[model samples]
Target: MPAAMTIDLSAIPADQRDAVAAVLRERDALKEINRRLEHLVAELNHAVHGKRSEKLSEDERQLSFEDLETAIAEVEESQDTQLSSKGKTRRPVRRNRGNLPKDLPRIEHVIEPASLECPHCQKMGGCGVMHKIGEDRTERLDIVPAQLRVIVTVRPKYACRACTDGVTQMPAPAHLIEGGLPTEGAIAHVLVSKYADHLPLHRQSQILARSGIDIHRGTLADWVGTAAFHLGPVVDRLAEHLKVSTKLFMDETTAPVLDPGRGKTKTGYLWALARDDRAWGGDDPPGVVFFYAPDRRGENAEKFLRGFDGVLQLDGYQGYNCLTRPSRKGGDPIRVAHCWAHARRKLKEVFDRDGSEIAAEGLRRIAEFYRVEANIRGTAPGQRLSARQARTVPLVAAFGEWLQEQRLRVSAKSRLGEKLAYIHRHWDGLQTFLHDGRVEIDSNSVENLIRPIALNRKNALFAGHDEGGRTWGRIASLIETAKTNVVEPFAYLKATLEAIAAGHPKSRIDELLPWNFTPSS
Candidate 1:
């Protein structure tokens, strides 16, 4: 159906024919090379100007330790079992139909036919009798808009008739905001909506107006500040708990605060420290606390982490080097555990930009380390240490040797060379997991914890002031910690606010922590 090309050697000179063929081959090769070059340029542009989440997709390959452990066990069990000689059969994958909460109330509606007479009988009411056969049922979710109402407290006064020495009246119930318009539940709702759901105060006020509640945004801010003031003690306890941990995953993100005098927003840092031992099967409950600093200087990190001596997991930021220095005061030097994900990110950028084989090999080598980690994850600390020594130690040594060899071969100023140098400089820290089983390969857990703050930042744009940023940090700490512990944040906040209003003792404040919290309590 198609025409075919035919070439005749006799029609053309021999020397010219060879030259023509060479030119055609060269053109084809140039076209392919130009295509690749264009692709590389596009990838570089996307990396430099596109969204930051492109890197997150690459990092997601490093699964959580618990999940990796389960996968490893399943693979091992399958390998140990006998296989059938018959060809393998594949089963269909079932799609998930999400379930509604069991606690949610359900409303039922029943429908019956207009006439109960059977069509076959053709008699009125089917011989004057009808029986039910079956019913088809369907369910749909519904919601009730938030309702606003007043809670009137009546404290009737009584006087003694015989002796009017003194008049006594029943005491009024305690409220989070004394004589304030909103109730404890209302304040809790606002806090959860603002911080957890990232709804700004003005937007919440607008929503409330639709319900016929004429509350000002300023009043909502006052309620938030009041709630933060009462929750201060609990946040303090959370900070203390986080500081005492032998290991912590730390990261920081920028938070802009409004400057009244300058009429512009100033940069601030929201420092996040998280502890999650469940990945290693430890008994300690997972929690995270945040601190807001005016800047991202090393001193802020030093001040925040003062009186703490243990492994501090983070990315390669020079600010943290002070904590790891021997001359640091108040405690032993904090061991720095650098994130391999960061190094992999550097290599990933290089690979995306130029498609270098060295960068690809570096990623492959790092992936191997993660593969060994997957096999040993969630085991006892001692067992994990032994497995790393036997399995991971050699791979690290070989990888280090390969890195050194590549460093000597490549130019120091090249991008791939720079990434290799970074790995060499942080080699000890990157291999910290080989020394201790408790340390993770990266600080992604804390990074994941900080994602909500990033979301809030995108919504709110900036904080009102330095104090407002601090309040954001404090409130986010409690809400995020509650989420980490699987506690319903709204229920926890409502109960905690009520307890504080009712004069709950600060000495027993730990009882109100997300881990120890119960709705009834």
Candidate 2:
């Protein structure tokens, strides 16, 4: 072991103390640089050989700086407590494995012994009988392949016995498509398969073919178009419902559509608006609506959100910035709440690349705000507002000051500098959560709602045309919203189509929404 070196300030001359302090600062800087270099090498190695997403794995947590801070806090608290504590330490307990859902019907198969006679007295055939005993049981999951069946409707003709009366027959039931081969259930199945399961119509056509049913892909497409036409009223109502919410989360994702003459796909945008007040314990049910636009211009957002006048939570996209700007017509501008996750993501990238202390500190400060949010997560809006005012407000103020100080220290052109500038620019929007507890700190809810569209895009590659894209959005909106409401998409869509076929009134369309829908047996 090396001997410890100690410096006594009193022994040193006052003039030389300044030089000593300068040397100590240089040593600390060198140590920090070395630490960063080591971290960078490790990160590079992981990037080359490990999983793509930057999310920490179980093993990676051991080296995580955030985990380090948590461990230190735990150690400090443990040191403050007595060794023989009265309270028990909460060791993590393993939970019992859950059985299969009781809702699923079970079929049993029993295996019997080949010989009923006892082995001890087989020659004598003891007792000439076998007594009852307990039996062992096990379960195995099974699936039934898709089967196609035809429904034959026969209408009996009736004629009056009196002379020259016109023949009368029972009117046929209302079908989604008059005289069409597919039933309402079949059409609902295709829609749910394409939109919810991300299966393209072409693949569905092939699957149907395997089941000995040959329906052309073009015909399937027509069926989808018809479904969209009939579901249009429901989509309109859903959009209106989403807009009426006081707080809404908005996001957009790229959707490619085929260009007829160009022989290639043109980029389109799917704008998603979602309302989820469950986090703040509000009574409103969660729902999402999607709109497809040919372009991602500011005018499109303006047009789509024309009637919406409330807090709009979104990311750092500049197109949405126009919504908050003073319009030439002069009206109440939509209040924008910037996503803290986006801001934190920028700094996280910096940390991942260079492991800079500045980025880490920024994340640490932002994490403090989220910590406050976690404490008030499921509380009522009033309680959440009170908690935010008591805890988050002061922390945000201090973080803002620290950010300003950081901006002054870093080079303006550097990556970290650019990120700090973004934070400073959106400071007011980021602080919106401090004023209104109903607004989320990030627009992750909307982003999550857009992920299904991204998956569908990956599978279908591109929509056939702009109209097809619009149809895709309308159907996906209902399916996803049903999923959000915990309603089975197929059951909801089937019931909805049947109701529409039965001439359900447009004036009472609210009952057809996913939240209010009741599945038919």
Candidate 3:
């Protein structure tokens, strides 16, 4: 049996007490290093073997566009229920069909045997069955595009012959453009082209030319630019409505802009703000609004979020602190939340770099927290909070203690040290979700929302200017928020644009907003 290594502190002489403390500190540091190595190995093994880890291991992640009905149906099927009143059983689509006997009877003979006669001997010979080989077949699930029809309105005016007053009976109802070449449908097409399709004006002109439309890209661009200008009031109203929500998720990404004067491009930031609560049913399901700035200073976020109050959940961006900071006018601070995914990501990166055993263990413990939340996804916010509180709070505390101990053992310049620093720095915000039932464990839902923009940015590169980027933000906010709320973006945009053109009251624009509105069946 090993003797208990205990020193009687009371009996230690005054001169040697400091020496004893130093020895104890060194012993503890060595123990921490050994523990970290063990944790790193365990994390590597878990990463190799776990399904959840496989999800995070992708290099170039693809954003999947899931059909809303299909997703709702999936939710229904898993619970052995139906989403629709028809009560049909919902089943998941099979990825691969199981093997069937090759000799199974066919509905029709795939090959009819052809009698062969020998050319040299004139004797009937049995024909050999041959199947032609071709290239390996690749398959994709087929989808049918929705049938679209444009309604053209023609109003004929007649003079009043009986009154002899030679007055046009009635002027035709006004259109978005009176003498302009583009019809309402044409304008809708152009808007959809520029915004939803991400096709630049020049590219669209060439495409129109291929279709014999003979419209210049400048004309399309002018029309769009004019439309966006005229719709400023509507956009402003939408932004105001979105900001009124009690919670907002925000993120930013780089957007490149063309500069004709400098003969070089410049980078800008696309700042987004939204209420991203898809799991919770509310007036604010999702309300994304975007802002564009030449620089990504904290002030840019401050400008967009002015007069907005309530929780702002975000990754650990210092810029967001500007939003949550107390106003000079003596108002409440913007409530802030830090994402757990960001913390986990930092640790994951460190573990990848240093292969630290402690980092791996920390990740495993953190992953267990996410696993509990995953099981309760889409449940009531209260239920999610309760589950997390029960399962996550303890793990987080232990992880924090572990981190503090490991921080002292690792080199301050090492990757492990950086991970510890990041976690420690954001510890308060990371754990704040535990106290609020409405808060989520991570900003993943908003991250999922931002991913599409990231993909689009990769393809289109950037917006034309700050105004162009703001337009992108405005449109993306409405569209992405509409998507999150299960409202078709194009349909919503088309209807909202029409309403705005018809002089719909700016104050009542909330009727056209994404989260507050639903599609007409």
Candidate 4:
């Protein structure tokens, strides 16, 4: 539908002018509806086969398009139903929903007819035999409400017949929550539900209430605090483990914390440090450790990265300018490698605001870098270095020359000029990947890991206190790191809690980590 056109309603009769205004309003609504539909259609086409600076993963694309199309359908209004034109009654396509897993326990319901014998056979004095030759089977999914069950521990008393011996029984087994109602498995479920599932304590309490269990959200917080206390050492170990790597990705997000002194919420931070060696096929396993700090001061980052001495790939945050210093107290100066995604995004913003050919060309050049990265992604670091040097070196040189030429022609005050300036200012860090194969082109590794924290933050709104923020970081760190290792969080956490309660030695603490996860462990 076209936009509503302006008309000389004042020249017409007043009575008809009112009707004309109403029609104009309706036309505007239609125009808006059409616009919404067109936008969704464009995104759908893009997901299907679109021009992009980077490609979304296959699973990501599939899930995205499916949801996008469903939303498109749900946006239809009553007038849209009437606009079907031909309204041809086409058969609804039967999509193939894959078969249910064989491992899933199924309950059988044998539906039988009142009479097995055919009516014709009975009428003909049973001349034809109605015997079973085969059985038809159909499977549909069903669900049972989750039920809470109690585990009873029996410690029978034993007595000696002579000498008035005291009654004796084996000592009760230790639990993660000492003498509390929840078992290790139950605590693990609660932790996973809150952190990974992003269900706040109040919501979880409500969920537990549905199962006839009365648990206060404050008690849930206590449980989480206890879990945090025991998990602190583990998180410390994990952070130290991450620091061992020569190169790592880093980023931070705001964590709103309640300030009891002022009786209101204050901004905090959860910094993510990540390592993904599979990109260059290195030996170190992937992991992420989140640190919660009261503020995003330079010292906070500096403290968190004390032992980490090598390249840190991150965004254009000036707080990390301290790392650029030639001389720092503790160890060798931490080298900073800035993100190309950040640089590209600067120009992409310009392109979005106004269709600038310069911005488009800049994005095109960045896209070429990603294209090369896609091919040699899983190769070894030395091999990646060889590929980048041979292929990306000349491209980078050409891009730099082109950037300088454009910058000279445009004013520094312009949007395109400002973005080009950013690239030029961070020219050394932007080319860091070309020099060191171990470092990634961007800090996306850590950014991807931090997304759940954002989701959790949104749901919970804010942490109750400074300690609450720290507790959030500790539990989330282990859960998300488990995911990076392809380990199921519930299982890993359950086993770890059990192991801790059973007095697993600190000397072998690494045994309880996610990578060592096994079903029977």
CA RMSD of all predictions: 13.7, 16.0, 20.5, 7.6
Question: What are the lDDT scores of the predictions, listed in order?
Answer: 0.84, 0.85, 0.69, 0.85
> Where does model 4 exceed 4 Å of error?
1-96, 118-120, 127-131
TM-score of each: 0.80, 0.80, 0.70, 0.84
lDDT for 423 (candidate 4): 92
Compose the digit string of candidate 2's lDDT tens values, residues 235-296: 99999988877988988999999999999999998999899898988888999888999999
Model 4 vs truth, CA RMSD = 7.6
Q: 1-521 in candidate 4: lDDT tens per residue?
A: 44556898898898899888876766666666678788889889888876451356444676788898887775554336434433634335345566787778989998776877788988978856467778897777888765689999999989999868698899999998888988888888889999999999999899889888999999988888888898888888888888989998989999999988998999999998888887888888888888999999877888889888989999988888887776654567888899989999898788877879999999999899998898889888888899999999888899999999999998999988899998998898889999888878888888889988988887899999888899899999899999999998999999899889888899998887777778772
> Clashes in model 3: which pairs?
36-358, 39-357, 40-356, 40-357
Which ranges of candidate 1 are over 4 A from the true structure?
1-98, 115-126, 158-168
Residues 1-521, candidate 3: write the lDDT tens digits.
34538878668999999888877765555455445545555555555565445355232422221233344444444334322223645456556644444544334324433644334354345444445555454344445433344456677667776787665645555566666776555665666666666676778788767666688877887777766765566567767776777777788877788776887789888887767666654545566666788888988887787777778788988876766655512236777788989888887876776677888988998888888777877777788778878887898888889888988988878777877788888888888788776788788766776676776676677777667877777666667767777886666666766676677786676687676665565
Candidate 3 Cα lDDT to native: 0.69
Write the residue-wise lDDT of candidate 1 on 1-521 in tens digits. 23434556567898799877765565555455455556555654554466443554332323333344455445434423312112333234334445677677888777877877666677444454468978786666677887678888888888899997987998888999998888899999999999999999999999999988889999999999999999999998988888888899999999999999999999999999899887688888899889999899987888888778889999998888888888876678898899999999999899888889999998999998889878977888888889889988998899999999999999999888889998888988998988888888888899989988988997999999999999999999999999999999999999999999999997899988888888763
The backbone clash count of each candidate, in order, is 0, 0, 4, 0
Error of 3 at 393 (Å): 1.5
Most TM-score-accurate candidate: 4
